[model samples]
Target: MKERIMSKDLMNKIDALGAQEYMSDAQLAVFEEHLRGEHERLIVRQQEITNTSMKNPESISGDEADKANAIQSSADARAESEKNKAMLRSVSVALQAIKTRDYGYCIKCGEEIGLKRMISQPAACRDIECETLEERKNKQNPAANLKIS
Candidate 1:
Protein backbone atom coordinates (compact mmCIF):
# COMPACT_ATOMS: atom_id res chain seq x y z
CA MET A 1 0.00 0.00 0.00
CA LYS A 2 2.82 2.39 0.84
CA GLU A 3 4.51 1.62 -2.46
CA ARG A 4 1.19 2.11 -4.19
CA ILE A 5 0.91 5.55 -2.65
CA MET A 6 4.43 6.54 -3.75
CA SER A 7 5.84 4.95 -6.87
CA LYS A 8 9.39 3.81 -7.72
CA ASP A 9 10.07 7.25 -9.16
CA LEU A 10 9.28 8.72 -5.76
CA MET A 11 11.83 6.42 -4.13
CA ASN A 12 14.45 7.49 -6.63
CA LYS A 13 13.67 11.10 -5.82
CA ILE A 14 14.07 10.44 -2.14
CA ASP A 15 17.40 8.79 -2.86
CA ALA A 16 18.53 11.84 -4.77
CA LEU A 17 17.56 14.01 -1.83
CA GLY A 18 19.67 11.91 0.55
CA ALA A 19 22.69 12.19 -1.78
CA GLN A 20 24.95 10.25 0.56
CA GLU A 21 27.10 7.20 -0.15
CA TYR A 22 25.99 5.50 3.07
CA MET A 23 23.47 2.65 2.85
CA SER A 24 20.17 4.25 3.97
CA ASP A 25 18.08 2.44 1.41
CA ALA A 26 17.48 -0.48 3.79
CA GLN A 27 16.12 1.83 6.47
CA LEU A 28 13.72 3.51 4.05
CA ALA A 29 12.61 0.13 2.78
CA VAL A 30 11.80 -0.93 6.33
CA PHE A 31 9.84 2.25 6.96
CA GLU A 32 7.86 1.77 3.76
CA GLU A 33 7.09 -1.82 4.78
CA HIS A 34 5.84 -0.60 8.14
CA LEU A 35 3.66 1.98 6.48
CA ARG A 36 2.21 -0.72 4.24
CA GLY A 37 1.25 -2.71 7.33
CA GLU A 38 -0.36 0.36 8.83
CA HIS A 39 -2.31 0.95 5.62
CA GLU A 40 -3.69 -2.58 5.80
CA ARG A 41 -4.73 -1.98 9.38
CA LEU A 42 -6.53 1.21 8.39
CA ILE A 43 -8.31 -0.66 5.62
CA VAL A 44 -9.49 -3.20 8.17
CA ARG A 45 -10.74 -0.44 10.45
CA GLN A 46 -12.69 1.13 7.56
CA GLN A 47 -14.17 -2.25 6.77
CA GLU A 48 -15.15 -2.71 10.40
CA ILE A 49 -17.00 0.59 10.33
CA THR A 50 -18.79 -0.42 7.14
CA ASN A 51 -19.80 -3.74 8.71
CA THR A 52 -20.98 -2.00 11.86
CA SER A 53 -23.11 0.38 9.83
CA MET A 54 -24.90 -2.60 8.34
CA LYS A 55 -25.20 -4.68 11.53
CA ASN A 56 -25.80 -2.18 14.32
CA PRO A 57 -29.44 -1.64 15.26
CA GLU A 58 -30.90 1.43 16.91
CA SER A 59 -30.21 1.07 20.59
CA ILE A 60 -33.19 0.96 22.97
CA SER A 61 -32.72 0.93 26.73
CA GLY A 62 -34.76 1.60 29.84
CA ASP A 63 -32.16 4.16 30.85
CA GLU A 64 -32.22 7.09 28.44
CA ALA A 65 -28.65 8.03 29.39
CA ASP A 66 -27.34 4.64 28.18
CA LYS A 67 -29.04 4.95 24.80
CA ALA A 68 -27.80 8.51 24.44
CA ASN A 69 -24.26 7.46 25.26
CA ALA A 70 -24.37 4.67 22.69
CA ILE A 71 -25.56 7.06 20.01
CA GLN A 72 -22.88 9.56 20.93
CA SER A 73 -20.18 6.90 20.77
CA SER A 74 -21.29 5.87 17.31
CA ALA A 75 -21.30 9.47 16.17
CA ASP A 76 -17.82 10.03 17.58
CA ALA A 77 -16.55 6.92 15.84
CA ARG A 78 -17.94 8.12 12.52
CA ALA A 79 -16.33 11.53 13.01
CA GLU A 80 -12.98 9.90 13.77
CA SER A 81 -13.23 7.73 10.68
CA GLU A 82 -13.79 10.83 8.60
CA LYS A 83 -10.73 12.42 10.16
CA ASN A 84 -8.67 9.33 9.28
CA LYS A 85 -9.80 9.59 5.67
CA ALA A 86 -8.62 13.18 5.60
CA MET A 87 -5.25 12.20 7.04
CA LEU A 88 -4.87 9.47 4.42
CA ARG A 89 -5.49 12.04 1.73
CA SER A 90 -2.86 14.26 3.29
CA VAL A 91 -0.46 11.34 3.25
CA SER A 92 -1.04 10.99 -0.47
CA VAL A 93 -0.30 14.67 -0.95
CA ALA A 94 2.86 14.37 1.09
CA LEU A 95 3.99 11.45 -1.04
CA GLN A 96 3.47 13.59 -4.10
CA ALA A 97 5.63 16.29 -2.55
CA ILE A 98 8.29 13.69 -1.92
CA LYS A 99 8.19 12.75 -5.56
CA THR A 100 8.54 16.39 -6.51
CA ARG A 101 11.70 16.65 -4.35
CA ASP A 102 9.99 19.08 -2.04
CA TYR A 103 9.40 16.87 0.97
CA GLY A 104 10.87 17.68 4.42
CA TYR A 105 11.01 21.39 3.64
CA CYS A 106 8.62 24.15 4.58
CA ILE A 107 6.49 25.19 1.64
CA LYS A 108 6.40 28.79 2.85
CA CYS A 109 10.02 29.28 3.97
CA GLY A 110 12.04 26.59 2.13
CA GLU A 111 13.66 25.49 5.40
CA GLU A 112 14.44 21.85 5.95
CA ILE A 113 12.01 20.28 8.38
CA GLY A 114 13.89 18.34 11.06
CA LEU A 115 13.97 14.56 10.71
CA LYS A 116 12.11 14.20 14.01
CA ARG A 117 9.30 16.41 12.79
CA MET A 118 8.89 14.46 9.52
CA ILE A 119 8.94 11.14 11.38
CA SER A 120 6.38 12.37 13.90
CA GLN A 121 4.16 14.12 11.35
CA PRO A 122 4.83 12.79 7.88
CA ALA A 123 1.97 14.77 6.31
CA ALA A 124 3.17 18.11 7.63
CA CYS A 125 3.76 20.58 4.79
CA ARG A 126 5.17 23.52 6.71
CA ASP A 127 8.09 23.62 9.09
CA ILE A 128 7.83 24.92 12.65
CA GLU A 129 8.32 28.55 11.62
CA CYS A 130 5.48 28.61 9.13
CA GLU A 131 3.23 26.34 11.18
CA THR A 132 3.59 28.46 14.31
CA LEU A 133 2.74 31.57 12.39
CA GLU A 134 -0.23 29.85 10.81
CA GLU A 135 -1.44 28.69 14.21
CA ARG A 136 -1.28 32.24 15.55
CA LYS A 137 -3.23 33.46 12.57
CA ASN A 138 -5.86 30.79 13.08
CA LYS A 139 -6.16 31.64 16.75
CA GLN A 140 -6.81 35.23 15.85
CA ASN A 141 -9.41 34.29 13.25
CA PRO A 142 -13.01 34.60 14.44
CA ALA A 143 -14.03 31.31 12.92
CA ALA A 144 -11.26 29.48 14.75
CA ASN A 145 -12.37 30.98 18.04
CA LEU A 146 -15.80 29.33 17.86
CA LYS A 147 -16.38 27.18 20.93
CA ILE A 148 -16.53 23.52 19.99
CA SER A 149 -16.01 21.89 23.35
Candidate 2:
Protein backbone atom coordinates (compact mmCIF):
# COMPACT_ATOMS: atom_id res chain seq x y z
CA MET A 1 0.00 0.00 0.00
CA LYS A 2 1.24 3.43 -0.96
CA GLU A 3 1.67 5.84 1.93
CA ARG A 4 -0.34 9.00 1.80
CA ILE A 5 1.85 12.13 1.82
CA MET A 6 1.05 15.63 2.85
CA SER A 7 1.68 18.44 0.42
CA LYS A 8 4.90 20.35 1.07
CA ASP A 9 3.35 23.78 1.14
CA LEU A 10 0.59 22.63 3.42
CA MET A 11 3.05 20.96 5.77
CA ASN A 12 5.25 24.03 5.91
CA LYS A 13 2.31 26.27 6.67
CA ILE A 14 1.10 23.85 9.34
CA ASP A 15 4.48 23.71 11.06
CA ALA A 16 4.87 27.47 11.05
CA LEU A 17 1.33 27.94 12.30
CA GLY A 18 1.73 25.28 15.00
CA ALA A 19 4.85 26.94 16.31
CA GLN A 20 3.14 30.32 16.41
CA GLU A 21 0.02 28.86 18.05
CA TYR A 22 2.05 27.35 20.86
CA MET A 23 4.21 30.43 21.37
CA SER A 24 1.37 32.92 21.05
CA ASP A 25 -0.95 31.03 23.40
CA ALA A 26 1.76 30.59 26.03
CA GLN A 27 2.87 34.21 25.76
CA LEU A 28 -0.70 35.44 25.84
CA ALA A 29 -1.30 33.56 29.10
CA VAL A 30 1.88 35.00 30.60
CA PHE A 31 0.95 38.51 29.45
CA GLU A 32 -2.56 38.21 30.88
CA GLU A 33 -1.07 37.25 34.26
CA HIS A 34 1.39 40.12 34.02
CA LEU A 35 -1.42 42.52 33.12
CA ARG A 36 -3.35 41.43 36.21
CA GLY A 37 -0.33 42.01 38.39
CA GLU A 38 0.23 45.38 36.78
CA HIS A 39 -3.40 46.29 37.23
CA GLU A 40 -3.16 45.57 40.95
CA ARG A 41 0.06 47.55 41.19
CA LEU A 42 -1.48 50.47 39.29
CA ILE A 43 -4.50 50.47 41.59
CA VAL A 44 -2.26 50.59 44.64
CA ARG A 45 -0.17 53.38 43.18
CA GLN A 46 -3.20 55.35 42.09
CA GLN A 47 -4.67 55.03 45.56
CA GLU A 48 -1.42 56.24 47.06
CA ILE A 49 -1.31 59.21 44.69
CA THR A 50 -4.90 60.10 45.43
CA ASN A 51 -4.30 59.79 49.17
CA THR A 52 -1.20 61.95 48.97
CA SER A 53 -3.00 64.53 46.89
CA MET A 54 -5.91 64.63 49.28
CA LYS A 55 -3.57 64.94 52.28
CA ASN A 56 -1.91 67.97 50.64
CA PRO A 57 -5.14 69.97 50.55
CA GLU A 58 -3.39 72.77 52.46
CA SER A 59 -0.99 73.19 49.50
CA ILE A 60 -3.88 74.23 47.32
CA SER A 61 -5.39 77.60 48.26
CA GLY A 62 -8.48 77.15 46.12
CA ASP A 63 -10.80 74.46 44.70
CA GLU A 64 -9.30 74.95 41.22
CA ALA A 65 -5.85 73.78 42.30
CA ASP A 66 -7.31 70.73 44.04
CA LYS A 67 -9.32 69.90 40.95
CA ALA A 68 -6.22 70.28 38.80
CA ASN A 69 -4.27 67.85 40.97
CA ALA A 70 -7.11 65.35 40.85
CA ILE A 71 -7.30 65.66 37.07
CA GLN A 72 -3.56 65.07 36.66
CA SER A 73 -3.69 61.93 38.78
CA SER A 74 -6.70 60.65 36.84
CA ALA A 75 -4.95 61.32 33.54
CA ASP A 76 -1.84 59.50 34.66
CA ALA A 77 -3.84 56.46 35.74
CA ARG A 78 -5.79 56.52 32.49
CA ALA A 79 -2.61 56.62 30.40
CA GLU A 80 -1.16 53.65 32.26
CA SER A 81 -4.39 51.70 31.81
CA GLU A 82 -4.45 52.53 28.11
CA LYS A 83 -0.90 51.22 27.64
CA ASN A 84 -1.70 47.95 29.38
CA LYS A 85 -4.89 47.53 27.37
CA ALA A 86 -3.01 48.13 24.12
CA MET A 87 -0.54 45.38 24.99
CA LEU A 88 -3.43 43.03 25.66
CA ARG A 89 -4.92 43.94 22.31
CA SER A 90 -1.67 43.07 20.52
CA VAL A 91 -1.57 39.67 22.20
CA SER A 92 -5.18 39.05 21.19
CA VAL A 93 -4.35 39.98 17.60
CA ALA A 94 -1.42 37.56 17.54
CA LEU A 95 -3.66 34.80 18.85
CA GLN A 96 -6.18 35.53 16.12
CA ALA A 97 -3.45 35.41 13.47
CA ILE A 98 -2.42 31.99 14.76
CA LYS A 99 -6.00 30.77 14.56
CA THR A 100 -6.20 31.90 10.97
CA ARG A 101 -2.90 30.10 10.14
CA ASP A 102 -1.41 33.37 8.98
CA TYR A 103 1.01 33.91 11.81
CA GLY A 104 4.56 33.44 10.54
CA TYR A 105 4.85 35.13 7.18
CA CYS A 106 5.99 38.63 6.39
CA ILE A 107 2.84 40.57 5.66
CA LYS A 108 4.62 42.80 3.15
CA CYS A 109 6.83 40.32 1.34
CA GLY A 110 4.94 37.04 1.62
CA GLU A 111 8.07 35.30 2.90
CA GLU A 112 8.47 33.18 5.99
CA ILE A 113 9.59 35.22 8.97
CA GLY A 114 12.64 33.66 10.61
CA LEU A 115 12.31 31.67 13.82
CA LYS A 116 14.55 34.04 15.74
CA ARG A 117 12.41 37.04 14.85
CA MET A 118 9.18 35.24 15.62
CA ILE A 119 10.54 33.93 18.91
CA SER A 120 11.63 37.38 19.93
CA GLN A 121 8.47 39.18 18.80
CA PRO A 122 5.67 36.83 17.85
CA ALA A 123 3.38 39.60 16.72
CA ALA A 124 5.78 40.89 14.06
CA CYS A 125 4.20 41.35 10.66
CA ARG A 126 7.35 41.69 8.57
CA ASP A 127 10.56 39.79 8.05
CA ILE A 128 13.89 41.48 8.62
CA GLU A 129 14.36 42.34 4.99
CA CYS A 130 10.99 43.93 4.57
CA GLU A 131 11.16 45.55 7.97
CA THR A 132 14.53 47.07 7.19
CA LEU A 133 13.20 48.46 3.95
CA GLU A 134 10.20 49.86 5.74
CA GLU A 135 12.43 51.48 8.35
CA ARG A 136 14.52 53.08 5.62
CA LYS A 137 11.43 54.34 3.87
CA ASN A 138 10.03 55.80 7.06
CA LYS A 139 13.36 57.47 7.82
CA GLN A 140 13.38 59.09 4.41
CA ASN A 141 9.81 60.28 4.56
CA PRO A 142 9.85 63.99 5.44
CA ALA A 143 6.53 63.73 7.20
CA ALA A 144 7.88 61.10 9.58
CA ASN A 145 10.21 63.62 11.20
CA LEU A 146 8.84 66.26 13.52
CA LYS A 147 10.46 69.69 13.34
CA ILE A 148 9.83 72.80 15.37
CA SER A 149 10.02 76.09 13.54
Instruction: Give the best candidate by TM-score.
Output: 1
TM-score of each prediction: 0.63, 0.44
> Can you write out model 1's per-residue Cα lDDT over 11-117, one digit (the tens) per residue?
44455556542224443443345345555666777777766654243645548787776677778778878876776666666656655767667889988776556
* Superposed model 1: Cα runs more than 4 Å off: 1-37, 53-63, 142-149
* Minimal lDDT window, size 10, model 2: 1-10
RMSD of each: 7.4, 13.1
For all candidates in order, the CA lDDT equals: 0.63, 0.58
- Candidate 2 residue pairs that clash: none
lDDT of 2: 0.58
**142 Cα displacement, candidate 2 (Å):** 9.4
